[model samples]
Each structure stands twice: as C-alpha cells, then as structure tokens.
Target: MADNATLKAQYLTQVEADLERNTKEKDRIATDLAALQEQLAVLEEDHALLVGVRQTLVGQAEAAAVTPAEVPVAAPAEAPVETPAEAPAAVVPRARKPRTAARKPKAAAPKKAKAAKAGVAEGGSAATAPTLVELVTAHLTGGAEPRSAAEIGTTLTQAHPDRKIQTTVVRNTLEALVAKGQALRSRQGRSVYYSAPEKVTASA
Candidate 1:
C-alpha cells in the first residue's frame, strides 16, 4: 500500500513538470507570432504607400496625354479673333514708316558683311575689325577640332584684351551662326561644340 502511494505522488509530480514546460513553450510561440504579425502589418503599410504613389503617377501621365488634345481644339476658336486684328496693322501705311526706316539700315548691312568677311579671311586687319559674329566663327573654324563657346569666349577675351566678353554672348553668336548655316552645331557628351560647316562636312 505505501509503494502504491509513492508511485502515485511521483507520477503527479512528473505530470505537473510537463504541464509547466508546455505552458512556457506556448508563451514563447505566442510572443514570436505577435512579432511576426507586427512585421506583416509594417510590410502591408509600405505596400499601400507604394501603390498610392504609382496610382498618382499614372493619373498625372493620363492628364498630360489629355492636355495636348485640348490645345488644337482651342487654337481654331482663337485664330479668327486674332487674324482680323493682325490684318489691319499689317496693311496700315503708318506701320510702313517704321519698316522703311528699318530697311535703311539693312541696306548698309551688306557692306558691313562684306568688310567683315574680308577681315575674317585676311586674319582681321586693324583697318577692318571683324564683327562679334565673325570673331566667333573665326575662333570656331581656327582649329581642326571643334571648340566650345566658353573656350572661344576665353580665347577672344585673351586676344582682344580691351572688351569684356561673356560666354553667353559667344553662345548666342554661335547659335545665330548655326541658324544662318555658317557654323555647325555638334555635341560631345554633355558639352555643345561648334565648327565651320565645311570642316564638319569634311569630318563626317
């Protein structure tokens, strides 16, 4: 009878120990599950934010594509109102005075152009100084390689020593020459370059 009681007590103690261990293991698993749930919520919030941004960008792109179609639709409505107003001004004799006055200087323009061309060809004599446009073209065509406007401006600054020249002015002059087909516009990487049309053709 005593052996039976001792065996029952030992079995109860072992069962209690197993129950305690199981409770601890359950607590640990619950804590890990809670942490995983929190991480999943964070990832979901991030996904929602990215989806919102993508939707906003798509909305903007759609709006941009629609806006250009509205321009041609509006242009014809606006053109009739503008044309009559422009027509009278275009034909008025009073407007001709200013235009005739402008043409007077234009007549002398060819003479200056001839002199400038001669100056550029003859290496720019003191008797006939080259214009800013001529000077820019000369500098661009001076080298076998193409030159940037900044470099040309610096060279002009060094050669003249009298006048202050801006790189912007040189750049504008170079563009004007390009528009007139006297100079070639080219790009090397990010920097714009200029050369004489003939040299550009030869290189090509």
Candidate 2:
C-alpha cells in the first residue's frame, strides 16, 4: 500500500512541473509575437516613405527624358506642338491649374490668428482688424520711436496692454505711412526701422 502511494505522489509532482513549463512557453511565445508586430509596423512606415521617394525620383527621370519638342513645358512652348491634340492637352494641364511656383516659402503667414486661437495671446481680431491709420495713431500715442515692423511687433505689447500686435500690422501701418509720406523706412544693418518722415515741408 505504501509503495503505491509513493508512485502516485511522484506522478502528481511531474504533472505540476509540466504545467509550469508550459505556462512559461506560452509567455515567451506571446512576447515574440508582440515584437514581430512592432517590426511589421516599422517596416510598413519605412516602405511608405521609400515609395514616396521612389515616385519623386521617377517623376524627375520622366521629366528629364522628354525632348524639347515633346517636353512638358510649364508655360509657353517655343514651337507649335506636333499634334493639335497635344498642344490642347498641354493647355489642358495648364487649364487644370498648374500649381504655382512653391509660393515664396510663405513664412507661415506669420500667423497671429493661429497664435491667438492657440491662446498664445488675447485680442485676436482686434489686433488684426485695426486699420493702418488707427495702428499708426496708436503706435505714436505710446511714445514709441517710429520702430520697424519687426521691432514694433517684438516689443509693442508692453505699451498697448490691450492688443496682441503682429509684424504684418506694423508693416501695413508703415506702408500706409510711407504712402502718405508720413513715415520713412530706415535700415540699421539688415533690420529696418521707421520714423516719422523727416518733417518734409512742402515747397511753397
């Protein structure tokens, strides 16, 4: 009876060990699966970027290959197209609106509105809506030297205390002043400054 009991106990011990080993194997497999999924995601992103680069290179090559007569011209062609259809087709592309040259790197519009929306400052519309005359009046009223658009924008908030100022507004005001001959632009190094025009006395 005692011998039978000992054999049974050993069998139970072996079963528990097997269960623990199986659990560890499952955990390892799960870890490996997670790693593979992450690798696949990275590979997909890399593939997309590579595809874009390849497409750009392909476009460059195609652009290079065409002879002047067969070439895709941006605006005016020197020679009459061989086929009227082709000329029209070229015109078609233009008609469809060729993207204008990359628009002067458009300094992000120096976005005062977006800054306001993002809570960078207050008086969003009020700052932008001020007319050129009004802005100049306000600028002068603050006892500020006629400052360039940049300098005015950089430090004008301290004086106004009620508006978020932008370089565009200052520039618009300066241009208006220049047009009226009320202010002159001065350049100190690369920086431009403005001061009320040298009080020009109109000739009698």
Candidate 3:
C-alpha cells in the first residue's frame, strides 16, 4: 500500500512540472507574436511615407508637363513690307457705307517708348539711355547676319543693365517692328533671325 502511494505522488509531481513548462512556452510565444506585430507596424509606416513621397513627385512632374516654356514664332515671309510711316496716311475701306465725314482716332504711340519715358522721369534710366526698340534696332544694324531674339536681348542687357527685359516681350516687339515694316524676319532651320530692312540692303 505504501508503494502504491509513493508511485501516485511521483506521477502528480511530474504532471505539475510538465504543466509549468507548457505555461512558460505559451508566454514565450505571446512575446514573439507581439514583437512581430510591432515590426509589421514599423514596415507599414515606412511604406506609407514612401507612397506619399512618390505621389508628391508625380504631381510635380504632371505640373511641369502641363506648363511648358514659350517658344518664339517665325514671320510668314522674308520680303520687306511697307513701314507704318511709308504706308498711306489715310486708309479708306472699300465696303464702308458713305455718310457724313467722321472724325478719326489718333494713332497710338509706341508703348515701349512711353514706358521708357516714364522710367526716365522716375530716375530709372538716364535720359540718354536708349529705348528697348532702339536697342534692338541698334543690334539689328550692327551686322549683316540676322540676330536672334536671345542675341538681341543679351546685347541690350549688356548695354543697359538697369533695363528689366524679358525675351518673350522682346520677341513680341520684334514682331511688331516686322509688322510696321521696320524689320525683316528670316528663318534658317529652327532659328528665327531679325534685322532692319535698311541694314539688310547695306549688308548686301
């Protein structure tokens, strides 16, 4: 009977030891699972940051693609046209209805010259400083070879550092001169060159 009792006690002790080991293993598994979850959270945060940066870059690229830099336009022909002064002083329309003589609007003065004059009064440029158009005309008259808008702008800037200039504005003024028959426009390949009509004759 004593032997039976001893055997039973030994079995109970072993069972208790086994239960303790199982409980420790369960606790270790829970700790490992929690560490894995924390690592996953960090990875998710990094992925979200990368996605945000990528989206920002994509938006900037789209904006750049949508808005491109302006390009200069070439004139229709190289032949010289009648200048504003040389053209007829009065323009009579063929289709206009005849009625009592009406007053005519005075010709508008060049905006560049007007602006330059204002600047001169404001002490921006010296009274002797050339106007934008004059500077461009001087550059055109400098050489036989036609000058591009960029070249003219650079020369003008070098000549008068105080003048604020934009290449597009210069290009538009050149086109206006062409319209007025003061300048000639020619295209060689993709480049457009301009020169005074009188200067073209001299170079020839």
Candidate 3 local Cα displacement, residue 150, angstroms: 0.7
Candidate 2 TM-score to native: 0.34
Tens-place lDDT digits, model 2, residues 17-85: 999999999999999999999778767754553464455456546877765645356335423322443
Model 3: how far is 48 from its true place, Å?
44
User: What's the distance in Å from true for residue 132, model 2?
Assistant: 33
What is the number of residue pairs that collide in model 2? 0
- For each of the candidates, the C-alpha root-mean-square deviation to the true structure, in angstroms, is 19.5, 25.8, 22.6
lDDT of 1 by residue, 1-204 (tens): 999999999999999999999999999999999999977876775455346445545655798999898768955864565455555556767845555444554566687689769868776466487678778877777778788878899999999988789886677667666656888877654456788877774333
All candidates: TM-score = 0.37, 0.34, 0.36
- Ranking of candidates on lDDT, top first: 1, 3, 2
Pitting candidate 1 against candidate 3, the one with the higher TM-score is 1
Can you list the residue pairs that collide in candidate 2?
none
Query: What digit string (tens of lDDT, one per residue) describes model 3 on residues 1-204?
Result: 999999999999999999999999999999999999977876775455346445545655797876663212223321223233233333546434222122111232355468658867877546566777787777787776788888888877787788788776677667767756888877654466788886564333
lDDT of 1 at 7: 100
Clash count of each predicted structure: 0, 0, 0
